[model samples]
Target: MRPIWVWLKGPLPAVPWPHSESRPDVDLTPEHVVVVGASLAGLRAVEAARRLGFPGRLTLVGDEEHLPYDRPPLSKEYLGDLPGVAPMLATAEDLRELDVELLLGAPAEALDLTARSLLIGGESVAYDRLLIATGATPRRLPGSEGLSGVCTLRGLSDAIRIRAAFDAGARVVVIGAGFIGSELASSARARGLDVTIVEALTTPLVRAVGAGAGAALSALHERNGTELLCGVGVEGLEQQRGAVTGVRLADGRLLPADLVIVGIGVVPATGWLAGSGLELENGIVVDETLRATADVWAAGDVARWMSPDFETLLRLEHWTNAAEMGAHAMKNLLDPEAAEPYRHIPYFWSDWYGHRIQFAGVPTGEPEVVTGSWTSDEFAALYHDGDRVVGALTLDRRGDIMKYRAMIGRRTSRREALAFAASRRQPIVAAAG
Candidate 1:
């Protein structure tokens, strides 16, 4: 069967799609840009707009009270309770210098795409260009809501609470073996806490890195003293007087726990645009230019746009994609005449138990070829769909990954990738350069 992405492929929208074309009354000035979701993507949108010479009313709205901060650290150093590991990306002075009107702690209640206005805090804010960077929220397990001692780490506050649990030496039961759950387990194990990770899949990160690499990661955690319960589904949460105490598994085993963290994944924050006439699927569907509707654009995890390079629509949740997509969305918003389709090679990295795992490109299909040993702490795996190098993953081999990143970017043939991978030549730097 063809891949889902192939099935979803369609013709790219013609240049100057509706609401993307220039209008006489439309204010193309900087101050007219309204960015929702005060996240890494949202903050970058405002900054990129300014850099693109958008000089007008620039307003940023966010549901969280805290200013934009780094989220990836929340699972690593922040979870370990390391001092001075602030995730703040921009300071108050920085926003002021950028002339960004930041409206923190105000959630967007409704969106008027036709009127090009956003309703927040009982006020309608008009905008010539609206960028939705609301990102995503952590998926919660059923019956876990309203229960104390249960947390989903998505924000700074969530990380703090989980850190406190770790500080208390709480027995942690993570409900997914994905990136977040695995990283949290690593942190909990580092603090000498009894950690257990339950994954419905056969291995960790099978979706991102494939079963082979995922199994290697699963073993990595097991070597670090984390209990691995793979291929088991959680039936429900066991609670004691409104507080979580344990997790009930599908096979009738009850895993006792002091704290439970659900890392099942996340859904895009597109609920506010429900009746606003924007097409919604896993995310807000946009054209090749990332325009959701007339005068409205979206970026980050919340916006799913057609990938001209990959030949399918993609909504990436990684930090790198969010920042790049935000800048691209804003640039197109400022200049629709010169608007270019969003084409990017997706990339992301995660730190787990003293190992840095980085991946570039899509990593689609099976693990067709590998450059080095997977059991080793340092190696790189090159994934291919037939003769085309689609993606690559590296374990502590940053330099090697960059080479494969370029190969995938150039759409190198499988023969070339294999030759590069199998070559016993020294100094890959010269060959790659």
Candidate 2:
């Protein structure tokens, strides 16, 4: 596979990468801090701000009518008809205890950076400090709209709707083989429904995990009876009476489907910040301290902050990153004078067909050394940038992910990591024939 560093480059070349964690000494505690976006990141920011004893008016503004809810389960447990409870991030009592004023269903129409105010629900809400944790919106395939049974699994409502259709024995066709699509396929297979995943890449999760691990995941999915159509592009959606029936491939092939899930990916939810004059590329460009501007800060999927660890600007969309960044964003908002760079060892996990896949660090570059067999069900592959172990991917190997995560933090050498992984006592478990 080609290097991922190359792909991360060349996007918005004008914005320079932050090289140092230095900012002017400006100490002013605001009486009110408005956190836009009421999702996981937004909720965590408010919680952290309150926990840190920020004796200010904390307001959370959300576009969705429902309160902040967990999103990761939307593709897993919540995709089934077993228990359809909306997993909330913060309940009424929790919000009350935290003393957070929640303005749900009020989407910020515009951000007045100069005036330090947000236009929400036709009223200008001024803030001493502003946090843009608006997150991101899923990208939909062109012409996929106006068709029934077409869904994007980004919100709680979308999961419920898809679960109901799947329970009714609808043939599932997922448009992307990313984590969401793969997880949804696994969930659909659990319901004994016909599931097919179409991916443009040669292997599943090629971008996140390396080629070897991605191939292992692809094999696992196929073994579990999930048909994977990789290295193919979807041309259009076939509709019958305003309902999607199937997907037409670029190669002039049709795959029948009763319900179509578009998990292609997401774009940063920064469209509302347009004309506000904040640096906007793929996301709100932030400094190492997660500061978008002098007083404006962003977190979660909306803010692309320079990573001191990786020495690159990263906009991580995983749940863990969102939680960690949310907490750090609040801390920085309270004390931007500290200029503590948000340096973190990125980590995320996924479950597919009963196998737990965990990865840490930037899983880019080439996999030069392997601990166990890649073809095996349980093994760990170490990726390296030259001699430095840059990242790691583990399948069904619990507890070992942390070891590699720390190793990446320490910048362990390739030889040391390979020897350490090879010295593990667990015997290699072969893939079931």
lDDT of each: 0.82, 0.83
Query: What digit string (tens of lDDT, one per residue) describes model 2 on residues 281-334?
Result: 999999999998888999999999899998998998889989989999999888
Which number leads on lDDT?
2
Taking all chains together, each candidate's TM-score versus the true structure is 0.90, 0.91
The deviation in Å at residue 47 for candidate 2 is 0.9
Clashes of each: 7, 0
Q: Which ten residues in a row have the lowest lDDT in candidate 2?
A: 1-10
Name the TM-score of candidate 2: 0.91
Clashing pairs in 2: none
The whole-model C-alpha lDDT of candidate 1 against the native structure comes to 0.82
